[model samples]
Target: MAISGGRIVIAFVNVIGLALLSCVADGAIQLAGRKHSLHIVRRPRGRNLAGGDPTVFNVMNFGAKTDDKTDNHGPFAQAWNAACQNIGPAKLVIPPGTYMAGQLYFQGPCKGSNPIIVEIQGTIKGTTDISEFQDDGWITFEYLDGLILTGGGTLDGQGAFAWKHNDCRKNINCQHLPKSLKIHRVNNSVIHDIKSVNPLGFHMFVTMSSNITVHHLDISAPADSPNTDGIHVSGSSFVDISHSKIGTGDDCISVGQGSTKVSISNILCGPGHGISVGSLGRTKGEGPVNGVLVKDCTLSQTTNGVRIKTFSKSTPNQASGIVFQDIVMDKVQNPILIDQNYGTSRKKAGKASSQSKVKISDVLYRNIRGSTNTSAAVSLSCSSVFPCERVELVDIDLVYDGTGSTKIVQNPTLSALCMNVKVKPGEHGLIVMEAKVSLGTL
Candidate 1:
């Protein structure tokens, strides 16, 4: 079920919010016209496990002190080793306390027969000092399957001081600071009920993984923190993210190239860049993105709301079957956008200045309503080289909040911009233009 060819049609007029249920059960999501279930990932049962009740391996037992100064890296590693190697089914617990941890790596492919649970009840604080991270990330859960990471605790990256060195916004060659949490090459995992706050870079990076469901997460950082994306998913598939409150400096949730069948719903995003699908197609041989559904989300005070951005002068690729529906914008800047001219200006693009090569197609924005702070609430600045095809905006009702700028346009509500994209007759709403798309007011 690689949802390619841009034929996926999933929509609902009214949506019901569903809580994250147990890991083994199929969580059926109720929608107005469709019922799509989040099939939680689970591997087959066999065993190196010691057939018994699950054992609890506490970090304190492995010489982890509950102080705020001593680095608990060794103790945490030892506990993960004991739990992954010694048990049929084990619970790795870090009890309630303030802990200073530097580069906590929970690498997996455990010998256990059953699922492994890493329950963190205390706060694990990261260093403001940049020399501590030898790897590219702080806390990494790599090469694991059937993991449950919960416990409502915080992975605090204490990034207020470290953000000064994060010059990726100004310097393109800046070495990125470590992300707070990285889930890489993992499968069949449920990460929920956690709070990840103030990372040096992205709060969570889910990359090269599949069959994962992430929900009930509260991720936040300063709105001005540079490059601090809340959750970034790249090169992954069959993922579901819902019921999260995310506010950060960068994208609250970003789906990059090679990602497919990603379902995002019930999110609260503000004080950051809104949920995005790109800034991609930079390098040659880059993969295409397809089968994305973003619905039932709310964006407030964000830079851009529900956008698909491809880099300028990009390589050849295609992005299709992307849907954004039932979204609410609360004083957002750009409530609906499709920018095919994104770039970092450290270096100039040379292929052609007029257009990009990435072909974007089959996008749907339906039932989106709210107020935007910007006068032009919608902008579809597609590429002139490849252009955009089969884009639709239906039932959109957005108005200017009258507080973004002092200089007001005569008709703010109908001030959407479109170029190099086509909306078929009887398949569009609001603004209508053949060559340059402008719409009627909501």
Candidate 2:
């Protein structure tokens, strides 16, 4: 897998090769990974799966230690309390090799029936001695309703022994380095064929869960590893991430602030930071982000593509029905963004407050085509005090192959940067960019 100009390049990865027999999205199965076969999520009407004859429970029969340094978190919590006291369908196997674990929680309301599986074929090494990570997740799965985490194993968060103590992005009172799978408040769950590597932060972190169903994953990290985000959804609600192959450094899927109906599709992001919903009103009872749907993704060399960040000290509706359709932006650097003055400080985002209170509304960017290095290919720096309502831009085809020294060939400056949102910002106005079909570049 190597494409130079159009950039793909990922030789191999597929840890166990992802396999989810259920959770119907109508049906389509080609499941390969690393270099892509994608097309998962479909065929499910069977609620909370893991049906009949399960009863496995074998973490080397509760004395787990694959010689990888012997610290299998108390034999994987005594094999998940004997498969959560096995009542019906149960299976908590973690066979194969290399195990060094430190914080393996897995608490549940489980007494069996309605799935209680946790396969993990092998290699779960995360104890580089970060003081045994007293929680912030290193494989935690709380109050599970009906979990069915898959196998294709590999959750190695050694993160080069904690990426030089990852100073929480410039030391904002740091000290939070665990994260290598933490699905809190787990409800009807289904995490498929996994393979997350190098994490000390954000690599599959769904919060306050609802009907969760993360798919065929293969998340990695290395691009100077800063934030390591690859599938992070906060406050969750009916979440469903799909056939993933994320390369992280940050935000290869980040929907923050009380997320709702989140559903990202067949993604294959790159040297990260793309696919976001919010920087979000910088913290203040911040909630309310409704229905988000990012579609068939492919963002190579990413920096920002398909984004919506808010933080002029936000939180009102903050965001609403957001959709980014059939995307494919290689050489990306800001393919399409909407930062309602995100983290200030460009002289505080050019003296911010174009009235910004956050509050965004029905947003959409359809069939977004690729190639942009940065000539500002679409940015709606919003916030004339809560602006951004029904925004639309259909079939946007981008192109501006920047080679660096501001290099651009043939009539460059492919622009789109509106301030007062090109419409109105608050008062819940009819703010829309309203582009139908053809709009510049390419």
Candidate 3:
């Protein structure tokens, strides 16, 4: 009824070997785990939630009054204050009803400081003129972190009345507009499962933040609506935007200056500027974007699908590690375009700078398939001084509905352009300038 010494020694050795193997597995997990570490929710440990944050916060406690004055922002503010006091992955719950609110300013950084989940069960209608919030700086989240905005509710930026009554309808430089949702210097924030329709200006503008994930969002402004971009990620890093449906007057997703480690996946966009990389030279003396990836996206009936734009007459900047792959386009006006002279109409006054310092390099587009409304499937307008270089295209196919020919407008120094170019009947490849062109079939 007793174990021998030899058996005990063997059991001890076996246990030590198992422990060593577990450590090896942990090492491998750490390498892959770093990418998924910046998630919205912190689970109990060893639970997988890839689509969204697994830690759910219920916002059903926040009551809504239907007959409440729409102009009074007090009830929601009080509720928000109470929710903020009850911290630790808490949700500012808005139950189903018409919740009338005004300019609600959230004063944070909060307790435990984990992301505060604001789940909208019903509509949170803004009361005052959205233009006034833009002018007066009403709703602004400054220097905060761990914030989540979820639920299938809309943040109505009631600017229709303001826009109709404004006197600067005919003026080009009307006024400095504000965005519906503005987050500045907030880190590790996630905005998911939300619909922001008809914002006053740009729907969401992320001025300075990092590790932001925007997923499963539906952003829309009218086709005739002006200055309403779906999502504008500026001056941020490590951003992942996926599962989004955007239709706006402006770009669906516009990556502005000082953004890096950006990935866009599984997006459907239309009636917009499509997915853009720049409009990158305006910054006086900052480095260009680095490590940008766009994959598994669709652009249907859009102005332009994939574009990398810079100014021809601006201070020299540089863009690197930009890639657009696995894209599908349908009835897009300009399926693919790269414009060096990316100035607004205001540039007609004069060149912003004497020479263009913006250097475009390592830009690659691959596996793009779809039909375009326009003939120019691919257009490159790189700067003369610092042109686009190291460009590659693999498995590029454009079927133009047998309607017209696809034209290729080249730049001065397209340093490298490689592709397997083909189109339907009556379609031909047109190159305005000389570049290294490789033609073959996939």
Give the whole-model CA lDDT for all candidates, comma-separated: 0.77, 0.73, 0.62
**TM-score pick, better of 1 and 3:** 1
What are the root-mean-square deviations of the candidates from the true structure over C-alphas? Answer: 9.8, 20.3, 18.1
Worst 10 residues of 1 by lDDT: 21-30
Looking at model 3, which ten-residue stretch has the lowest summed lDDT? 26-35
TM per candidate: 0.83, 0.34, 0.73
Supply every candidate's count of residue pairs whose N, Cα or C atoms clash at under 3 angstroms: 5, 12, 7
After TM-score superposition, what is the CA distance of residue 142 in candidate 1 from its true location, in Å?
0.6
* Best of the candidates, TM-score: 1
Off by more than 4 A, model 1: 1-52, 344-351, 403-414, 423-442
Q: Write candidate 2's Cα lDDT for 1-442 as tens digits.
A: 2323212212112112212111111111111111212223343344557477887989897788788888888878988988888888888989889898788888978787767889999889887788767778888889878888888999988787678768777864477677899899888788898899888888878888888888889999896787889888998788888888999898889999888888899899988988899777766786888888889889987888889887765555567778788899887888888887765666766553434587776676777887787667776666665556546555566666666525565665555544543222322432222233332444
Taking all chains together, the TM-score of candidate 3 against the true structure is: 0.73
User: Residue 292: error of model 1 in Å?
Assistant: 0.6
Ranking by lDDT: 1, 2, 3
